[model samples]
Target chain A: MTTLVSEAIRAPYDFLAWLVGLWSDALYAVGDALGIGMLEYVFMHHAFLVGTLIAVMAPLVGTFLVHRQMALIGDALAHTAFAGVAVGLFVNSILGTGISPYLTAVVVAMLAALAIELISEVTDAYNDVSMAIVLSTGFALGAVLISVNTGGLAVGINQYLFGNLATVSRENAVLLVVLFLLVSVVVTVTYKQLLYVTFDETAARVAGIDVTWYNRLMTTLTALVVVGAMQIMGVILVAAMLVVPVAAAAQVARGFRESLLASVVLAQIAVLVGITLSYRYEATAGGTIVLVAVAVYIGMVLAGKLQSRRGVSEEAGTGSVAREIDAGTGESTDD
Target chain B: MSLEGIPSVGVGGVETSRESAEAGEGRRGEGTADADRVVDAVDLTFGYAAAPVVESVSFGVDRGEYVGIVGPNGSGKSTLLRLVLGLHEPDSGHARLLGHPSLAFAERERVGYVAQDVTENTKRMPITVAEVVLMGRFPHAGFGRVTETDREHAREALRTVGIERLADRKITALSGGQRQRAYIARALAGEAELLVLDEPTVGVDAESVDAFFDLLADLNDEGMTILLVEHDIGAVLERASRVICLNREVYFDGSPAAFAGSDALERAYGTNLGLGAKTETDSRGDGS
Candidate 1:
């Protein structure tokens, strides 16, 4: 499946042209289903399944990460997985084996999380220092391992660095579907505990939230999300998979749940639009997706800021009119 | 963690050996230990990264007693308060609250704590004072949707604090004193047996200080035990029944007058309590 994606776009807009053909098939199916239009049901079903997979996965967990301020940490750990992938590839090549990259990436990211937690506690080292150490060492070791191998493991490593979504495989997409549901369920069940930990960690600790355990669990879960998104986002730009969707949602979300829902919606929209347009324009799908997500983020931020400014002026004008009434009544407070 | 054998900092600025201090203090007054001691700290010790900042300490506050803790900067007064509040784990000995090993959330609700600043949350402000105060009910009601009973209690607490009218205002919109009061209301909404406040008077203007203290005094009179960490003892001492002076360790624990005029303060500090900063000849407790 990955091999097909690896070869999907032979030229610019190649995939898009194929999608158009697929769309015609979809129109035919829809027309058959409705007996009215030219669209096909099979195409819509396939698009919906794939679109749903892309939209729901990254952004769901991404919102949680962004709300908790672990977005950059997501990026750091993804790179940290590089060393693991590199090491796995070298061992596989040497042993005449082909280890699953997802398995290797996840294992490395978990190890990185363990190392991060350990460093934060046992030493005076800052979180960024620990992240930096994992990131640089991971990439360096991965490079060293790949340099010794004559195969295209180096090119594979570049997939993580630059994201080659064009080459995503069927089995991997199915794996993504399973993972998307798994993460969503786990997060929902532990929603309150997560928010409590995010809001006031110390208070949560004093409240007996078992903060240390939650910290480790959350980091590991975040790693899992990273590994899942890596197929579409690529390793290099995977942090966006963990951050942008959530950040954009946060700008307008009324609460924690609202933010989560908004992020999922935005991610799906961006993924479909980016993938469709990239195929149309003959551009990199992953790059186009990130660009769209970023534009959405900027728009949300600008709109939110304007709304807040308007609210402030309205408040100021109302404040003075109520001032004399307050004084006369001896309420003496705008509060 | 040397809470057992290390000498505590001298009281009233008096640097003396344990033998001399014990022998010298018996004649001062009768040291009455509380029967219903809620906070029992025995040989308590704490440090940041293992260089002992708070030395061996021992003290007890009875149930429903409003004790004010006063000290100079770097005196570890706030550190001691944190230990009692269960924010920082003590290095050694025992710091118990309500017979528990330390403060727990459900248990801590019995112990309301308001830090100095009480900074409003940075996230979108929850609408209404009723909503803000109901946040204090978090220990009792974990997360997700809030209940009607919670809002009712918050309203009752607001009415108690005489700020029921401000019940609808955003917490960020409240003044410094009003905000502090609202925080108190939040703490009070907990219906806590003991309210631990750290420097509740810092940066509050003189009038606000009087009002804050007056409000605190009124609450204390109504049977809520307040363990406060205050910087300026002048106004607080006027209302405080017992004063606990911490300078890396317990300086003295006794009556307010003995604390103000005694050689314990003169020895631990450099001089007697400097008077004339206020307009009142406040009452003081007998030295023991």
Candidate 2:
């Protein structure tokens, strides 16, 4: 049946397969001359490609979420995706189905995202309360399913928990690409609306923008990002990738666009460095990635404090001679 | 532009006809022209639960009227502003904006609102003053990028509030007065005719309060209809052409001089509280 389906959709899949194959082989050839043949493996290629995609997707959505003070939602949805993966595996073993758990994760995570919005809307609960409710419920359900799994279907659960670079298959890589494009397009198209809602929701609402609908769109997009990133970032650290990069960028970036752009650049660097270090050191990919992001965040915080202090000192300078001395010292330091 | 297509849904009068007319007007960038009333509340009642916070409130804000609503704490001053802004649906009766019922009113660019507690809400947000002001153009721009004209409007608004120099400064970095001016600039940038501000001077300094009221006066003189929900009754009476004293209902709706001389203030304040700004010393003395 798998072969029949592949044959039916052969042309497009073949094109994608060939394109990725050629791209990876070209990179491997370059890596061979540099004494870095690690890129030769198909799984390594998948890890890097999917890792890059997640780096872009996570922070792009996370910027708005962070500004709106809904950062915990990312973690909540990631846990829900974990439960979703458990449910998929459980159902597959019970029914002898060959369904992909990642697909189920996407469905479950999006529903949970909507659920968070609905719960907050219907009740007077704070956003964090709703998030905590969903978070605990999701993890508990995952635990229950794991405990109930007598058919040994939970074997791959560890990979989803802490993440393994080798586990991101070609099929899931394709899904990540689709998710990346979807998230990017949505964010780019609705950038202004998102900015309005993020900065001042009441004003945005009065301005005739459908605040609720945009909010749901944002959360659903976050769910997509989480599910796509879960393979590389894992359920536990998935939200770190979403938040840490944006937090670091916010320390320095002057505006939202700059914040988003800088966050993507920062996340990309973290993912690349983390993946390479993990491959070299035989470390867990998710933990390595999140640690790198945290380091970057710390570095940015220290730099921001130093910059603000300098600004204050420059303002407190007495006269033109002190200002000239300050400029000279600044230029000398630049050297 | 005429009020022919203005919606009347929540107001419940010829409502179905308004629904059909609004479908066309909603697309038109320029909505209805002035039909006198910028904000019209007729027997509006609202509450979070069983006991109504505001009940049987009724008033009309004529075009170019700088109407100040004054009330005690929890007297539904903010809620009434929310009702006029279409943030909350009333339990009964109706509120209208630009001659359209609040629920169906969708001419967003024509109206701007500044919420209370904005400074607290935006404490950690990393947006600049210009960016905050640029948000006022969101309604006109929709899902699109801000145009040069939008930028110009934002700059003009900043100039109007005398904070043009601080446009690039981060909102969190501004002083309380500067922050309040930035908020006013945000509302002005939308090119709104009706500006509804809730407690804009709550956290501002004493000097900035005078400047802020003066700026509001300048805007009102320039033909912008202002609805200010203020705690400072004496200050509001000095600036506003009309005063609406609300304690869940319209106690008095008339000129500042009329409200100053009327017994409505004594009744609302439960004493012979001086409503005149000139009697400031006497009022303060009486309160003490």
Best by DockQ: 2
Candidate 2's fnat? 0.45
In order, the Cα lDDT scores of the candidates are: 0.66, 0.80
Per-residue lDDT over B1-288 for candidate 2, one digit per residue giving the tens place of the 0 to 100 score: 323423332222253234323422442343434486688777788999999988877666767878899977787999999998888999988888987888899889899887665758656667788998998888888877789999999998887777776677677767666677777788889999998998988877786677667777778877899999998887877778767776665555655665655555655554544344326623543443
Candidate 1 C-alpha lDDT tens digits along A51-76 = 45656767766665665555677777
Worst 10 residues of 1 chain B by lDDT: B278-287
Candidate 2 local Cα displacement, residue A93, angstroms: 0.9
Docking class of 1: incorrect
State the weakest 10-residue window (summed lDDT) of model 2 chain A: A326-335
| Candidate 2 accuracy as TM-score | 0.88
DockQ values, each candidate: 0.19, 0.25
Candidate 2 Cα deviation (angstroms), residue A61 = 0.9
